[model samples]
Target: MKTGGVLLQQKTKKNINITIRNLTISDITHQYCNWLNDKETNKYLESRFTEWNMQSLLDYYHQKNKSELMLAIIEDDTGTHVGNVKVSAIDKNHHRAEIGIIIGDKNLWGKGIATTAIGIVAEYCFDVLDIHKLTAGAYAENLASINAFISNGFIVEGQRKEHVLTPSGWSDVVLLGKIKSQE
Candidate 1:
């Protein structure tokens, strides 16, 4: 598991300063577990299928920390852990990876935190990790997530019709991608 160290920082348009850091086991708490189990928060997330408890969450953290970059989004002003951004499915030989994000704090929604976090992490993937391409997918109804990636220069690459099963029935998935600038 990666130690908890601030990896990136940026200021959102709303003037909220946030930082991204390697998530540690200690970061897992009852509140964090609640965020995952919350219906509205995890609606578009695959994790919604599973019930999340502290033990299960810890197990997940252990598994993901091994192969992917699991980052925590922290509100710098109040020093609170607000959410997470994951860079997973990393194909080193192909220089590509998939990015996923969740802003668990409902009160913090629509504050440009997702957009800013995605931007910072995308920069790290391209410049620091030497990843050539980054991809993300969102449920068709998840305009907030799609727009967040779009705001950071990701283009909608394609859409998979009826790609995922949801509570409301099958839903389309919007695929978005961004290539590292050559310059």
Candidate 2:
């Protein structure tokens, strides 16, 4: 657990050798920028509505916010950066945060990496950060994300009617959340 400096915490899954660590300046690469620009990848993301550029990415990486934690998902075997997971909008007083994940590697989609990372981050939120609950929202049509959250113990808490406007028209957003187990 690298708790000080830029790194917050580290987690590695033995089954897939996938590691999650604090996102650093060095991790801001062209591939990541491309992911943000890729329509297919960003279709369901709110950021898809914005144009992405190197400068914007640099600014994003440099921005400081105490209430959010962004992490990079790495494939330990090949040293490949696969995706990102973010726990943001943290309300420390309320012990809660909003979580989101983006697995940029299309090849790695459908794998259980997102689920594993979500579980690890949720545990970190509860056991390390002392957060009481975690929340996430996904487009109603994003079954993969919904399934990943559910498989990681999140439950559908509610739905926002036509929360987002897509090219296909308005789409609902499913709200999901999980509370730290009182053990």
> lDDT of candidate 1 vs native?
0.93
Which residue pairs of candidate 1 clash? none
Q: What are the models' TM-scores?
A: 0.96, 0.91
Candidate 1 per-residue lDDT, tens place, 1-183, comes to 122345799999999999999998888998899999999999999989889999999999999998989999999999999999999999978999999999999999999999999999998888788899999999999999999999999999999999999999999999999999998
Q: Model 1: runs farther than 4 Å from truth?
A: 1-6
Give a tens-digit lDDT track for model 2, residues 66-166: 34688888987898989999888788678888899999999988768888888888888888888899999999999999999999899999999999998
lDDT of 2 at 4: 33
> Which candidate ranks first by lDDT, i.e. highest?
1
For candidate 1, the 10 contiguous residues with the lowest summed lDDT are 1-10
Q: Residue 55 lDDT in model 2?
A: 80
Candidate number with greatest TM-score: 1
For all candidates in order, the CA lDDT equals 0.93, 0.84
